[model samples]
Target: MASKRPQSPPISLVELRKRCRDASLSEQELTDYFLPDEENSKPFAPALKLNEALVDVGRARPGPDAISKLYADATRAQTPLPKKPRVLTQTFRRAAKTKLLAEGDSWFNLPDYIYPKTAIDFLGSDNDFDVSNIALWGDELEAMVRAKQYRQPLRSGLFGHFLFSGGGNDVLGSIPAYVKPRKSGDTDPAHAADYVKATFPQKISQMMGFYRSLANDARDATAGRVVLYVHGYANAIPKKGGHYLGGPFETLGFDPVAHAPLCRAIVAQMVKLFNDALQSFAQSTAHVVYNDLRPAMTERDWYRDEIHPNESGARKIARIFAESVRANTPGV
Candidate 1:
């Protein structure tokens, strides 16, 4: 008889490592995982030391689940802004027959006032549509799937649509490391385009793989009746290396004045690269639709920062998403 293949790990060690990097794990949990049980066995000494150091600095807390719970609570608190009067609303309304499930990063988790209507809000607004959003801030494409953030919601029931917003955080988080110092009078667009062409292939392939896996999972869970909607980001113009909500990216070591133009270039290039990948993915996959919100978003003054959208901006993107769904899905 042939030997059985090695069993896979029950939980994603990668996700666990990501949690540790984010400081989402408690001191005790880190100690239990990294340290030897009886002091005789080998331990991950560096991680133990780091854990101890974090505790000393009051960064490590008591409960292992506390930080994760806090994150979930924060995400849940992002309620939709009260519906504006007819004059303020610009998007067409269509009642939906299907439930909506959303997963991604801060684009979906940031408060409605700040990031505005997530795609789910648009799909669920007019119909008896139940919505479940499991998006978390700072989430990357692979991390969300590896952690099963999308899977948990699928268990609730059969959803008619799965709206995904990701890949932006992954690019934004990595690009600064790759951006080169600009030569005097170097055009921002050219430099940005070059950086994207050089870096996007590998990242795009990785993102495509994650999306493929997600598509497979959704098909299994929903019997191929669910529609997957992937979106592209709008161009962002950052005046400085700081987030809109608060927090400075100055610690990342870029000169705010010298690098600001390059940052804008990167944002524009990132949107194009992501949208291109999304369009290609949609072409290859069944029931996957790519919604290009960039055109509508670019013309409006909806951005909160370089990457996130304000409430008005969110409404515009949501409107586009809703219209796309109404047009694409049969019997919706």
Candidate 2:
């Protein structure tokens, strides 16, 4: 009989990191073995409490059923009574103070740290302004709108300022195709521009629809008192390519050394396209402000990986956003 094959021991986190650095294991393999299936696959939640809150409200749908039963009972009664005049009294109270509501993807989600602190610290350490974040990891613009997540907090009419960060994932999702290797001697710029021209219109329209709906909802809920702020992404080094996180680009299944330049160029163009679209949308929409963080972010050592910013970077973004809010909103 053949001897039984020896089973390999489980890989520790340390071993995993070492293998990732050595390029001995792919990110997908690591994720499959170490991470929960849901974590690896499900889209991130908008807010910690959003799902629970939705469930709580969902249970209240039976309220109308009770009202219908009451109507049925009233119809069975045959007696009539004289009606009494109703007294009316009016009580007035101050309007609730406005708060900031943030929504978007991982940039605002900040997996490793307390994200709201970045914005809250800049707004005021004393907590003068309330801030709520509903960002999720791996969220696309269309998904958020389709889920109706944007309308949830706005429905309360309590938010006075809106902070949004998105479109990064949309671009990232298309990166593999966007940076696909072309034939030898093909002009990179022309090829990239052609891709952008063909793909960006439909993408931009989808993004615009999200913005328009958000703007219209804010106006309806807050009577146009809410201010919307959107920021552009900073440039990143393509050579790194998610190395810190053991991301797909770590292996890339291609010649990384040869393709690095084209990848970088494609990233730059993608950022520009998204930012230009955001600027144009902001220009056309009322009460919308676009902050071009590219110049500052490009200079700052803020990125933790190819896609995410470290604490320092987050703080800088918060400061810029806070300044914009303070300037536009009358009494900060």
Candidate 3:
């Protein structure tokens, strides 16, 4: 009997770039794959298009004809009770139920093929909340705010909460650009601040401004009642296991093994800067809650890779979020 060849998994936009690079897929093929759709035509990666559709489902309002019929029925004679009262009551009841609108990076948007689980996946299963997760893999906070893809859903007045998980990609994903190659005769410092590029601080400040804008928008959209829940990443120990992020460190002349301490410090600094900003925002801003995820997933066993947490870890993070929602929000 002949031996069978090993099978490869299906392809998707999440890792299309890697496959294209390895197989030398042509530009025309990519064009054919994503063209004819206006959102997909944007200059960014193709994966964002998928997220845009997933999260930007506009108001599900009745059509003009349906409205006319409903109006006629409500005003018609011989009708003991008008349908308007019942309809309004139902709408109000639904509006009172907790609905969540989420946007962020890979932690909230990891593909099902890789781990079949994410924080949102677990959170959605919780009884108290209904989640509209629009997170995309490799998304940065700057891009998420600039896109304002959640604006439509937010203004629809259907959601009572906004969940955010960002900043990690803004710092960690851009490591190759933000981290500088060490100089000769330079002793390794206790922190990696000296190794980081000057622009990193400016970038973080800009992201904070965007975050404030988003929170204010959510508040204004819902008449100051929208609760924004934001979470920060746990400190991940850098390892050469995942398909993403780690390669760039080595390419920039920073060896994972030789510069292990510096790598750890870089990640630690990134987490601190991000989490601190989130905590400050939570304390200062109205209707905002920050959940520090570090304490929950401090051990290496909590992680599935260098960056993302495993299923058990995601469950713990989800539990933290659910508890916050239960304690803070008025109704489920």
Candidate 4:
């Protein structure tokens, strides 16, 4: 019998940790550690929400009427924006049909099928069918396939999917400032500030862009609603977590010269970016969720360095997001 192989999460956050521990990486350097090397990588799961809503990308097809409705819905969504999901007024079923054919058998390989539409259309609200207004945004089905691929490896069935790889952050440096120290942690605030100022925004922006791509991809592929759940900062994992991983953001207390309000300000910026960038997906019933993690972050449990969390801590954050989407989100 073939030996049973161990599987990895769509995101092997643990593997990311190990690589970081052995090496001293810059914010950008550590980020590269998490990205997908699709050519040599194994398959895994797509992001969480994708698996639930749009499961089968290849075999699924929308009826002709559904395509028209999606266009109409998109139109009304862009204009004065529909506060609720009402029927769209204007529609063009014939032209919509012609556009779908442009993709040929699968449109799977087209880049346009998965990027933001610059803006969402509200005029074609009457289009309740599957096709989008211009057939630009497309992903849900493809996302699911990609997500599963990332969860593991290709041989195991998850290699080509989209993976979360934001050029890494300065967690090694930041965790100490906001978090109280354990034993004798590094009291270097400037190091933390540098991490926050230099690295945080880039990662947040990168992640948001990834989500936008997926959202468009979902619309094109499934012609349905998309949602985002905000899973923000947590209390540190006591000690060693940040130090162990070597990220710059791991809290190390305040340093007189290098420290500033950079950590607080950067986290604030991340929240704004997630909210404002995502707000454009209006018209479509997308939602953003926020919450303070349970078991609360503590100064002690954050690894030995007073930053980063053990698997347990990371789970709490992931859970807030995972549970909310499961609980809310209509017909998801």
How close is every model to the real structure, measured as TM-score?
0.65, 0.62, 0.67, 0.32
Q: Return the lDDT, model 2, position 308.
A: 58
Given candidate 3, what's the lDDT at residue 328?
Answer: 79
Number of the top lDDT candidate: 3
Residue 177 of model 4, lDDT score: 35
Predicted candidate 1 versus true structure: per-residue lDDT over 168-245, tens digit per residue: 765544455444444556555557766454556677778888988988888777777788888877776554534521
**Candidate 1, poorest ten consecutive residues by summed lDDT:** 40-49
lDDT of 2 by residue, 206-283 (tens): 777887776787777678878888876766545444542123434434233455555556566777777888899899
Q: Specify the poorest-scoring 10-residue window by lDDT in model 2.
A: 45-54
For each candidate in turn, give its C-alpha RMSD to the true structure in angstroms. 14.8, 16.0, 13.1, 18.9
Model 4, global lDDT: 0.30
| Tens-digit lDDT string for candidate 4 (161-223) | 111211112222233332333224444334433333344556445555554554454434433
TM value for model 1: 0.65
Q: Which pairs clash inside model 3?
A: none
Among these predicted structures, which one has the highest TM-score?
A: 3
lDDT of 2: 0.54
Ranking by TM-score: 3, 1, 2, 4
Where model 2 places Cα greater than 4 Å from the true spot, the runs are 1-98, 113-128, 185-197, 240-261, 299-302
